[model samples]
Each structure stands twice: as structure tokens, then as C-alpha cells.
Target: MSHPQAKVHRMFEFVEAIGTLAFSEMPNEEFLALGMRNYWDGYFAGRAAPLGLAPAEVVHAVFYNFADGEVARHIPWVWGKTTPAEAIAVRERGSAAALRQLIGDLADSPGLVRVADLATRAAVSAPIEGRVLYAGLRALDVPEEPVARIWHAATLLREHRGDGHNAALVAHGIGGTEAHVLFALALGMRAEEFGRVQHLPKAQLAAVVDGLRGRGLVDAAGGFTAAGRETRERIEALTDELAAPAYDVLSADELDELITGLEPIAAAASTVDD
Candidate 1:
């Protein structure tokens, strides 16, 4: 029998591999030099429009997963400087240029193209996971080479799951700073640790902790209350449910095959480190 989490595993590892295209050990100096204010601006600007969100909205929605100061420092700089469409266009152009520059002849390497083709084929079959990602892909005006398609397909699947997870968080009354705190608590992280990764100021995070405590989702010591643990599980369960539609298009056998094909690429990508 195929593994039950095969599709989930495939989605995550493929996403990881594609992520390395932009964030691997390669120098981003060339990409950063593409006339953007900074790396954050270029990176965030490119995705802003496809997310259908303003810069501040993007910060609020997704910044917790990144560095603590990104929201505070970068949003103000990128917003209103360029229109959303323009910014996304700039981001795409810059990212593609950077990838091309970095990958060099590797862009057309037979092994790379072969893997990309396999990934894209699986992505095409993913209705649920591919929905948001496919929309973003459709909005792009850039030409796709083998490497570009690989990255874009993987990114779409990842973001589709991410967008659903965010929605699940909000639907469960766990938005904003509070969501970050609760998530960390559920994972057994300490307050100080979560604080370092959270975008909220200490004062704000403290307040959020206080607020969650009142709701019995967190203890005074920033640990999860029973209710908190249950809620966190529910959020994850719902997020998986929301993401399942995409994977549903594939049979268990197909999922097994996809995961088998993608794991090596993910391992190779991970080796690049930070």
C-alpha cells in the first residue's frame, strides 16, 4: 500500500527543493543589485500581487515565518513605491535573472529538465494544491525554461498549502501575533525563542500572551493549555483538509511514485545549506 502521507511528503520536499533555487548558498548579490532597495523588498514585492494583498497585509499575514524585523523594516519601503503588478513583474524578472545567472548551464542540464518535467506533470494533476499557485502562474508574463517551470510549479503547490493554512489559522480565531505565539507554544518552544522569530515587539507579544492566557489557550508560563493544544491540532487538521483536494486528484500509487521521484532532489537541494 502507498503511504498515507505520500502526497504531503511530496509537496513539502518538492517545495524545499524549489526554495533552494532562490535561497541556496549561491550569492544573491547579483539579484539584489537589480535596482531594488534591498533583498526583502525585491523578494516580498514579487509575491505581493499574486497574493492579492497590500504590503502591510502581506507582512501581517506571512512575516511571522521570516525574520523578526522584516515587517517593521521592509514593508514601509516597498509599499507605494511601485504598483502591485509592477512590483510582481520586477520580482519575477529579477528572480529569473538571478536564477539564470546562478544556474548557468545547469538551467538546461538534462537531469534538471527531467526532474522539472516530472514535477510539473504532477503539479498539473493537483487541483486543490495547485489552485492558488496556478493562478499566480497564469498571472506571470515571463517565459518559462525548464528550470523556471520547476521552481514555479513547486512554489505554487507550497503557497497553495500555505494560503490554506493561514486561512485555517484565521478561521480558528488565531490570527496575528497571537497565532505565532500559540503555534510556537504548541511546538514546545519557549516564549523567548518564539519572540525571536515573531515579528511583534516584546510588548505586543507579551500582550498577546496575556490575551491568550485569558482564553485558556496558554498558561502564565507561555505553555499551551489543554484547550490550546486541541485548537492547534484542529487548525493543522483543517489546513490538511483544505490542502487535500489537490492531492486527491492523484491516486495513492501516483503519490507514491511522485514522492519517490522527488526525494533525491530535495535532499540534494538541502545540502546547499544557508
Candidate 2:
């Protein structure tokens, strides 16, 4: 089978390569100028841990990806292969602009929130999901790219919720449809109630309900099942991960302030998935 984790491998590889720059035998001034210092030190070395590479490898990954243009460049090896001195060379102030663009380009960026509404619930509830997700990323020992897909999937679910409360539901077979229909058939509306609230035609609704029942995420009565429970756990975990760094850096009140910023994101993350 194709590797499901290819994106993770690539992302980690990015970190691994960029982290190496710190040890480049270049001038200390040149190294510092690149903005390659404490970033990796704090992330990979901190709670993220040695994920099959040493501290330096992670930094090298970012530098190489930027030089090669695997990500944002939408091009191939933009910088080509250059000696460490050539790569880090700086002759004029223009170098500053170049460095800034380079940093912005290479950043994992457009964080999930940027691409879509992150959390829909109270920003605090959503952060719980972000914090868990980051933890999952750490546990996976992969880069954030693959894990991002999961978050993107969650964002889709939130959008699905209010409109049919499933604007983004990918037919996950749970009550969420968007949120993986987290609660079971029992928790979901009853058959007659569905008749009243459902946006789908009667025939289509029956089919959809049948599909959910077959999947074991729901029952005839629309109660939750073990599989459905797992889906919620996964979403909850991801949200927690996204919010953890803020939680760590900010005081409780400060964290609340940050959550306020994340509200839009939480809404976006709950999308309907396929």
C-alpha cells in the first residue's frame, strides 16, 4: 500500500535538514543572521523530542526545504546546491529582505486557522482539541503536515454542524456527519425527530441513516457506538495539540486571550469530511 505517512516523513525530514545548519562551520554571525538559532532548540528539543534525528538535523531540514523549494516555492530547488558559505552569504541589506521572505516561505504556516475557521466552540474548548492534536503530532514523531490533514478534516466538520449542522460532513457515519457524528444513534435525534429536522428528502435521509447504522457509528435509534466514540476522541485530541504551545507560553488568563483569537479557527476545523 502507498505509505499513509509520507507527508509526515517529508515534514520531519524538513526539520531534520534545517536543524543541521546550526553546526555548519560558518561564521557565528552568519549563522545567527539566518534566524536558525533557538527556534528548533525550543521546539524539537523541548517537548517534541528527538524524533529519529538529533537536534541539528531538524534545523537542517527547514533550510534544505527552503533552498530546494519543496514546499512554498511551488518550484524545484530554487537555490540549487550551494556551499554552506554560498547559502549563508550576505553582501547587502537586500539580503535582509531575502532572508525574511525565505523565513516566511518556509514556515509551515497559514496555520490551520489561517486556512479555515479553527474551533467553533468556546475558544477554550477548542484549544483542548488543539493541545491534544499537538501531542498526537509529538507522539507520531512526524512533522505537522500529515497531522494537519486530520485537523483540516476536523475543520470541515465544524462547518457541517449548523447547516444540517453538517455543511462539511463527509458522511463519517456518526451523529456529527461533520464531527464524525460523535454521539450515537441514541444521542442523535430520534427517527421521528429526524423526520422533522432533517434537510434531506425522506428517502435520502433513510439511506443516510441506514449507512450510519451499518457502519456501527450509530444505531436505528441514533445512539453512539464504540467507533463513534473513537472519532470524537480523535477530534478532541487534535484540538488539544493545536492549543498546547499557547497554553504553555501563556498564563491562564493570557491563554484565554489567545483562545479568543482562535474562535474562528475552531469553527473552521469542524468541517464535513469524506
Candidate 3:
């Protein structure tokens, strides 16, 4: 049988797919209406709001995947456009609006209510040590509205797992850019396309790829070698192990219920333009 933690890990993408609509697919008009410059401004400011005007380096470190300069461009500046409290409110509002648009009356269904309660239990039960983003978010009040509550809980669980994933990458000696490369390859993304989407300069990306090749992680064609694939798998396994604790509060049946209830919502969220 697969490790129970592996089951928890499989739920990661589902929760993220749902939770990120708060910003990822938030209406551009609503974001602009906040006096924000663009999506990146809302993304950086809103997500980091829980940390209360944290320095760019802190956001960069916690976010772990964005290029440092990209983060520096937004933080502190974005705060000037909107206070942390306003960002938080808009984040919840946008998330709730998106969820309602996608799931409609189903947001109030008893199944979702139960899922929200169970997910909230698991999220709040997660240990805070070393989970900077999750810890900060957990310090906020849970939304009282049912749909908003579900989004809030999902966001908590997403960050809890994300913090653990970053630790796993660090332990494996995977740098931020390298992590993106590995993930892109794992998803069968072409290196050129990956670089384009991530906005990685070709020279910088080539340097990282060269470094990976030197470590026997990438082949001459820039694909993962056997060792490379194994390394990625091991890191993910460790991440799953670290994230396992958050789900300890759920019974087997409850866990299954949570997954079942979330599947449709995640599917709905995924239909939005990326």
C-alpha cells in the first residue's frame, strides 16, 4: 500500500488549484481597483499580507521559487499601494467570489460545510514550527462565511504543505530555479517553454542547467537523467512525510470525504483560464 502520507501529498495539487483562485484567477479589474499595478502586485502583496509588510528578502525566502529581483520589485512598494489589512480582506473577498462563481449554490451544501470543518481542523492542527507562511496565515481569524471559510482553510493547508516542500528542496540541495526546472521537466514541459513562462533569462537558465548536468542530474538534451528523476522523487517523498502530520487529525473516512468533496470544486477551479 502507498504510505498514508503519499495520499496526503496527492491532495496537494487539488487544494492548490482551488486555493490559488484567490489571486491567480482573481478578476483583473478587481485587483486594479485596489490601486495595485497588476496581478503580480496583488499576488505578492496579498499573499504576504499575513506577514505584515515583511521585507522583500523575507518574502523571497518564504516564497522560494520566484526570482529574487521579481520579489524585490513588488514588496514594500505594493504595501504602499494597499495596507496589509486591505490586502487580506480583498484576498478573501476575491477568493470567495471566484469560488461562488465556479461552484454556485454548492458552496453552501452540507458536504462542503463538512469539508470546510474537517479541512479547518487539519489546517489548524498542523504544527507551526518552521512554517513561516502557514504560521502567519494561521494567526488570522477563520472566515465565518461558509465559502470563504473553505477557501481560507484550503489556503492554510496549501501553505503548510508548501513550507514543508521548500524544506525538502533545501535538504536536497535544490535551488529555487533548479526546483522550477525539475518540476517543469517532471510535467513534460520543454525547457524553452518553461523558461518563457518563468521569465528566466536564457543565460541564467543555461547556467542552472549546466550546473545540473555537472551534478549528473540533467542529460545533454536538458532532460532528467535517471539520477535526476530519482532525486526529484526522493524530495517529493520527504515533502510528503513532512506534510503528513497535518492530516493526523482526520479519520480515514473523513480524509476520503474531504478528497471527494474537493474534487468537483478543484475541477471547477481548474477550468478557469490559467
Candidate 4:
């Protein structure tokens, strides 16, 4: 019997690899500065250009994932000397450069080829459900390395999930910060302690919570009200529905196979620096 949950788990390995490799070290000033100088832009238009969205729309959409206050706080420090457009142009170059350096410095592990092969298999199996994500990733010009290919496939999958998640948030009328706060609450995280990883200001979080409480979605103590839990579940269900297309391309057994094949590589990569 094939299990859909297996596909989700399998796909997560690829997703985790990208997160570890590309984003985990983002808070490190040197890495953050480099990325801000090349990829991320604080300005609406600059950030919106590569995404092909209106600046205003992009600003709203970005907050769904990054939270506005955090982006504002970090941008000045990350790319003080660079313009948004300039940063966009060099984003890929910088990523590739970093990959080259990482690969050079690390011991030549056999996992590279294994992970790349698994990623390619998943990419080929990806269906039209991920069409937008696939197209966006395909447009990236990067070196022909196993690591690069894995990163590309992982990014496509990640964006596919993100696009769906964003749609769900909009559909539910959840403001960006409130959504994060509610989600953290739903997961049993203390709201006051949430900003450590998300980098949101305590005041910004409080304001969002106040609004949520006003709507009866949150309690005064920063816990989720009954309605809030339902809202969170609905949002997750819708997001999963939207992200289902790509996984639908593979058989349960095939996904399991992919997952099994990538396990060693995932373990190895996780030990590497972000």
C-alpha cells in the first residue's frame, strides 16, 4: 500500500538540504551581508523585481514568510552599500561562489552524486502542479554540479510550497505577523519567545497579538482561541492541497525509494556548516 505521507517525508529531505545549505547561516553577518549585497533587497521594487510582482504586492507577500519588521531591521546592515537591482544581479553569482568554496573546503564525500541523482529524479517526476516553481528555478544559470542541481530542485519544491502557503494565508485574511504568532501558539511555543528564530521585534509581535485577540482568534495570554486553532488547521490543509500536485507525480514506492536513496546524503550534509 502506498502512503502519501511518505512522499511528504521524502520531499522534506530535499527541502531540509536547501535550508541547511542556503539559509541556516543567514544570520551570520558575513553570510548575511553577502546575500543582502547580492540577493535580498529591502526596497519594495528591488525585492519585487525578480519575483515579477508589483512592489506593493511583493512587500505584502514577502511579509507572509519573512515578516516586515525583521526584513527592515536586517537590510540596512546587510547591504548598506549596494542597490537592490545590483544585489539581484549578483545573487546567483554569489551563491555559486559560496557553493564552490564550500565544496572545495569540505572533504570530498560520495554523498554529492547520490543526492544530486535523487534530486534530478524528483525534478523529472515533478508535475505541472509545480509549473511556476519549475519555470522560475529553470531560469537560474548556475554551474553544472551535482550540488547545484540539488539546490535547484530543492528551491523549486520549496517555492512550490511557499506559493501555496502564501495563498492560504491570504485566503484566511491572516496578517503576516499574526499568522506567525498564531502558528507559534498553535505549536505550543510561547509567543514572547518566538522572535529568537524569526527575528521579529517584541513590540511588533505584541501588536499583532492584540489584533488577533480583538478578533477572538487569540487569548490575552497569547494562546490560540478555538477559532485560531481551526484557522490554522484550515490554512495548513489548503497549503497541503496546493502542494499536492508535485508529489502526485510519484508513486508512493518511488517516493520511498527517493527518500531512502537520499538519507545518507542528507545526514552527511546536515553535518556540514549552514
Candidate 5:
């Protein structure tokens, strides 16, 4: 579970992807380019520093995400007035080798990892969004081995609204895949629409559904069979091991500002803007 550098773990990628997806509100393409993976790399490494994480461990933790396209390209760009080039020689090549050398050097740098980790933790944890997500993950026990395997897989699909992929949690699970296909089917889409949303080949999609049917997960009507319903129930149980947050705390004034723009689309509101 300690895959500071885990894209290679396959299972890690699935779970990590899920954790990432459940947290994002942006579209897939935008999230993909957000440098989130690198941000995490910097984050975990910093923890391993003065907080008790060694610089070497930080490097490894981050390295794993880099392979998942989470880190994507290891390059530098402008950050307001600060460029990575100003302090880190690793930016010179923008390659994994470059990243390694730089991180390797920082392994011995005084107070650097501490600073990075603190900054990252501050930025990530301060958000309302971050609070909700951590609350959820901090509550999980992975249910069963099949779920643990595909949790990340579910994340992969969840993160992107359009980009082609499935959640990481199910990447290696036959039963997981079976559940996934039925879940999608139940959501209601024609073959063409389903084709557009599916991350796998059409045949693969059919096969997953077929496998579920073969195992009696679906009935003759193509809905969940008793066995399939049990699977669905299990997945749902895992999802709610903790209470989901309620978003009803908005004040009349605050809610007014939030929904004011959509008043035209909705009904007229008595709460007017200042």
C-alpha cells in the first residue's frame, strides 16, 4: 500500500485512480494536464523528509505515479515568477533521468523536502473538496480482494468524463469487470452511445457482460440476476461504509449568489444580488 512509486503495481494504479477520480470535479482532459501526480510526488516526498520521510522514499513514492500518466511529462513551465530551472538542474532535460537526479540531490538537501511537503499539504488540505475526499478514503477498508484490485480501475473511469478508461480498482478483476459492465448497462445507453462511453473494445465490453450473464449475474431480460444483484449490493455497501457529505449548509444569501445565474434556467428567486 506504500507505493510512493506505484504506477507499476497495477493494483496501485487502480486504487490511486479511484482516489483521484472521487476527488475531481473537472473534465478528464483538464485533470490529466493538471500536474496532480507531480504535485503528489512533491507532497509525499516532503512528508518523508523532516516529518520523518526520508528523501529517498519521497523520490520513490513520486516515481510510481509518473508512470501512470498521473505525473504525465516530467517537464518545467512558468510558475508566475518562479521557474524550476532557477533552483533545480533536473529541469534541464525534462526526462525521468533528470527527475531522478534532481530528487536524488534533494535527498540530502537541508529542509527542502519539509518545505515542499508543508506547502503541498497546505494547498491540498485547505480546500473544501480535499476535506470531503480525505474523509471518504480515510474511511475505506477495501471490502474484499476483488474490490481492492479494481478500486483504482474505477477511479480511472471516474476521473474522466470523456477520455477512454475504466476505474483502476477493477483492472485485473473478472468479477469486477462483470460488475462494471452491468453497472454501465443499467445506466441505460444504446449500443452507439455505449460505444462512445466505453473505454475498452466493444468486444471486451460484450465479453464482460457475457461473463456476468454466464455466471448468472444478469437475467434473461438483461437486467441484474439474483447473483448480479448481490454483486451490486456488495459494491453499494462498500460505497457507503461511511456517510456521504450533505451539501445543504449554504446560507440563503450564499445560495442566492450561487444560483443567481441559473435563475433564468430555474425559477425566479426572491433573494436578489446586492
Candidate 6:
């Protein structure tokens, strides 16, 4: 049988999709109307809003994936364009609108209302120690609207999981670039693609890959060796284990209901155009 935590990790993706769609699909005009220069400006500002104008270094440390310079380029400067409150409003509004567009009447159905309630309980009950981003999000007031409430709760859970994942990576001594390379190899994606998407310099990417190879985590052909795969698996398992605490507040039946209720909504959200 799969680890119980694995189920929570896997099933949470459907709710994650809703938040991802909201962030990526929010219209350009909406951002522009807020005096934000571009998508990145809005994205950085909106995501970091909960921290109340945090420094670029803080965002880089918490986000734990993007290159430091990439984060420095947007934050603080993005705050100059709009206040944290305004950015949060845009994010929540966009999330609600995206859910409505994707799931239609299902956005307000009894099933979703239950999900909002259950997810909120899990989110709020999550322990705050060492979960900086999740704690920041927890400080925000829950949205009154059903769709927004669900989105907000999902986002909280996502960040809670993300913080745990970062801790797992750190414990394994994997740096940010190395983490990307390992994940790409795990997904069978080309290393170059991750480099391009993350804007990592070619030399830096090659060096990280070389380091992985030296450690026997990667083969000469740029794929995970047996040990490498095992390492990645361990990291993921630990991440699930860390993320499990949030859902501990729910009963078995409530957890099942949360997962089942999200199934159709996640399926519908998946149909969105790429």
C-alpha cells in the first residue's frame, strides 16, 4: 500500500491546480490596471504580499527555488508599484474568477462548500513553527466567498507543503540549482529545459550536473542513477511526512470527503487550455 501521507500529497494537486491557474491565467489587463508593470511584477508582489513588504533576500529564502538575483529584480520594487493589500486583493479576486470560469456552478456547490470548510480547518490547524510562508498566509483573514475561500485554503496547504519540501531539500544538502536538476531528471525532462525556464546560466547548470555526477546521483548520460532515484524518492517521502501534520485535525471520513469532493473539480480544472 502507498504511504498514507502520499495520498494527501497526491490528492492535494487538484486544489493546487486551481491556485496555479489563478496565478498564471489572471489577465494582463487586470495586472496593468493595478499599476503593475508586467506579469512577474504582479506575481512576485502578490505571492509575497502576505509577508507585508518583505525584503528580496527573505523572499528568496522562503521561495527557495528561484535564483536570488531573479527574486531581487522584482521584490521591494514591485511593492513600490502597489501595496501588499492591493496585491492580495488582486490575487484573491483572480483566484475566485478563475475557479468560476473553470468549474462554473460547481464553484458554489455544496461539495465545494464542504471542501472550503475542511481545507480551512486543515490550513488553520497547521503548525506554524518553521513554516514562514504558510504562517504569513495563515495570518490573512479567510475569504467570505465560497470560491475564494477554497482557493485561499488550497494556497495555504500548498505553501505549507512547499515549506516542508524546502526543509527536506535542505536536510539532504541539495542547493536550489541542484534541486531543479534532480527534479528534472526525476520527471525525465531535459536538463536544458529547466536551465532555460529557470534562467540559470549554462556553466552553472553544467557545474551542478557535474557535482551530481561526482556524487553518483546522476549518470554520464544526465539521468538519475539507481542511487539518485532512491535519494529523490527519500526526499519526496520525507516531504509527505512533514506535510501530514496539517491534515491530522481531520477524521478519516472527513479526509475522504475532502479528497472525493475535489476529484471532479480537479478533473474539470485540468481541462483548461495550456
Number of the top-ranking candidate, with lDDT as the measure? 3
Residues 1-274 of candidate 6 have per-residue lDDT tens digits of 1238756876568667766655656634566787887777877888889999889999999988886588888889987778988888888887678777888889767677788888789888889999999999999999978778878887888889889999999999887778888889887886777643446777877888899999999999999999999999999888888888888888888888888877777777677665
Q: Write the per-residue lDDT of candidate 1 for residues 213-234, one digit (tens) a residue.
A: 9999988777988999899888
Give candidate 6 regions above 4 Å deviation. 1-3, 27-29, 195-198
Worst 10 residues of 5 by lDDT: 265-274
TM-score of 2: 0.27
Q: Arrange candidates by TM-score, highest first: which order?
A: 3, 6, 1, 4, 5, 2
- Could you tally the backbone clashes for each prediction? 2, 82, 0, 1, 27, 0
lDDT of residue 104 for candidate 3:
75
Compose the digit string of candidate 4's lDDT tens values, residues 68-142: 554554444433454544544444334334444455533245666665665665555545442443454445553
Q: Higher TM-score: candidate 1 or 3?
A: 3
Give the per-residue lDDT of model 5 (tens digit) for 1-274.
1111111122222223333322222222222343434443333222112212223433333222122222222222212222322212211112222222323443344443333232222222211332322323223332222222122223222222111121222332334345445555567532224533255567765665666677787665567767766666554433322111111233334323423322221121111111
What lDDT, from 0 to 1, does candidate 1 have? Answer: 0.61
Give the worst 10-residue stretch by lDDT in candidate 4. Answer: 40-49
lDDT against the true structure, per candidate, is 0.61, 0.32, 0.84, 0.57, 0.31, 0.81
**Best of the candidates, TM-score:** 3
Residue 175, candidate 2: alpha-carbon lDDT: 39
lDDT of 2 by residue, 62-176 (tens): 2221121112221112122222223323211222222223344322345533322222122123222322222222233111342232232232222121222121232333333
Which RMSD does model 6 reach against the true structure?
2.2
Worst 10 residues of 6 by lDDT: 21-30
lDDT winner between candidates 4 and 6: 6
At residue 139, candidate 3 shows an lDDT of 94
lDDT per residue (tens digit) for residues 80-144 in model 3: 78898888888888888898888877876877788788878888998999999999999999997
Candidate 4: lDDT of 180?
A: 68
Query: Over all chains combined, what TM-score does candidate 4 have?
Result: 0.69
